[model samples]
Target: MGFRNLQTFLFFLLLMLLGLSAPLSAAEGKRLALVVGNSAYTATTPLANAAADARAFAAFLKENGFEVDSLINVDRAGFARGLSTFSKKIGPADTALFYFAGHGMQLKGENFLLGLDAELLSEFDVDAEAIALNSITGIMERKASLSLLFVDACRNNPIADRLNASVEGVTRGAALKWGWRR
Candidate 1:
């Protein structure tokens, strides 16, 4: 019985090696992407230069052989739609990436990317208006083999300059809220 099992294992290993050697190659199919820039804001004021950034990045991604789906000034509805659309557009893509450049904050120890026109009125609005970082993971869960996410949003309230003066005492806090975990 032991010898028969060993022979069976060797046969399976040989078959796997043969399969690996087979020319199962396909053109790097379609590369899907989601690029978001929150530049135009109403309550919290507009971001500095995120719109231009997103445009430039989208162009770069296309040049680098990617089918990009980018959205600028994505609000609540726009953000949701962009996510759903991007997920659906991925058709046998060799690579999938999600990128964001805008205002973002951490509440309840969770990452939230702030969209354009997001008002920091109450903390609950963080979950309401902003896109949860994990949401990206969930929507992209079974979409691709190797997934990539890039977030360039700052954690600081972008309008802290005015907010500090208007309020009373709120010095600039540390800017270490954008660290990544593996």
Candidate 2:
């Protein structure tokens, strides 16, 4: 499918997963969203569409009554700060949503979302340089009544390939073992 089509599908799928047939109303409790896009990467080739897509998506969410926190071309520390602030806003009755558009890779079954300043020289750097996907989900699962995560980061990752190549017992295909599934 086309990129726009895929995004629409994912948005509808997310709403369906949350048992929502239409845009949420004010009576449904608070709606919070953290939207991030990292395009200006220093270590890897920059993405052309990520930041723009995030801005558009954030606007859409705002129109639908979501209080949005949007960040673009952010570094690791910036990402952490955004998440920390977002987590603070979430409440037990809130519906929390996270959307990320950038580079992402799976290493040893764990998914890591890359920031603009991420430099993955080895697998060891993942924890320090990248944001763990589960960390975002864990926050939402803990503080929100309903949580939705939409990751629009799928591209050829030369950094991951290099890391896999450098590590012993790590195969080229090992990164593909995990996928988004319910």
Candidate 3:
């Protein structure tokens, strides 16, 4: 390929890598959202409320005439893909929102949202499955006059454990035991 061809290729490649997509609006503005629910846990209890919360919020967004995209029961890979897809769907002057429900924890001076099946025997294993909140937020901050974020993953232990002994199988996770539910 000639130098000019190479330059053009690189330019388009850069845009694709950056998750840039068609602008949401050429006239009337539109809204987009990334709704995530991480409720899979291996070590501790799984959050039963995450699924419900995600569904409810997505419904609300749709009712408000926003294009609500979602990835429920997402692990790390799913989360990353969701973010990428969402970024491409939003643009400057457009509105976007993100809603999360599941388990969230603070580790190594960073915040991590745990998947329902997250098994964090130690902190070192966190980043693999849990992504930084900023990774999701920074996308919305790119020219969105109105960016909204609803984080419901703050429910107690920030980490869910399968149903607790205290609940006698009535409830299926320690996360809800700690009043961590919608």
Candidate 4:
């Protein structure tokens, strides 16, 4: 399917999943969402529709009874701060949802979502600048009964070429796990 169509499908799928999940916590719970879109990248190719997708998804979530926290073109500091703020808001009874549309990568068996101002000069810089997929998942896993993480990122990007470079001991079969939908 086309990119826009895929995004639409994913949004509807989230809505349906949330709808189904709502009744499970109907007795006592709140729906919370953190929607992030990183379109302007300094180290990689810029995306055409990530910001728009985030905005639309945030709107849909807000209309569907979620207390939404939306962000666009976030830098590394902003990204970290946003997560920290969102995590503090999550409660045991909250169904937390995280949605991200941007560039992402995986190295050394760890997945990462790139920030708007991320400068991936070397693989080592990833840990310092990018958001780890597991970190996001871990935060939600701690507090929420039901947590959903949706990431719309490039699967095969030119940035992946760095892994292929004969840089001493860097592994060859590194799988770039971009999307984090759970």
- State the lDDT of candidate 4 residue by residue for 31-138, as single tens digits: 889999988887778898889889988987777778999889999899999999999999988889999988877676767787888776577776887888888988
Q: Rank the candidates by TM-score, best first.
A: 2, 4, 1, 3
Q: Which stretches of candidate 4 lie over 4 Å from their true place?
A: 2-8, 20-27, 166-182
Residue 167 in model 1: lDDT: 47
| Model 2 per-residue lDDT at 180 | 45
Flag the better candidate by TM-score, 1 or 3: 1
Residue-pair clashes per candidate: 0, 0, 14, 0
Candidate 3 CA-lDDT value? 0.62
* Model 3, residue 32: C-alpha shift (Å): 0.4
Q: Which tens-of-lDDT digit does each residue in 1-182 have in candidate 3?
A: 55357446634653453234554445545677788876665555677667776877677657555688888887767678778888887877666778888777655344566664566554456667567776666667765655666676544662323222222222212221112211
- Candidate 1 matches the true fold with a TM-score of 0.69
Poorest lDDT segment (10 consecutive residues) of candidate 2: 170-179
Best by TM-score: 2
How does each model score on TM-score? 0.69, 0.84, 0.67, 0.82
Displacement of the residue 139 alpha carbon in candidate 3, Å: 1.9
Ranking by lDDT: 2, 4, 1, 3
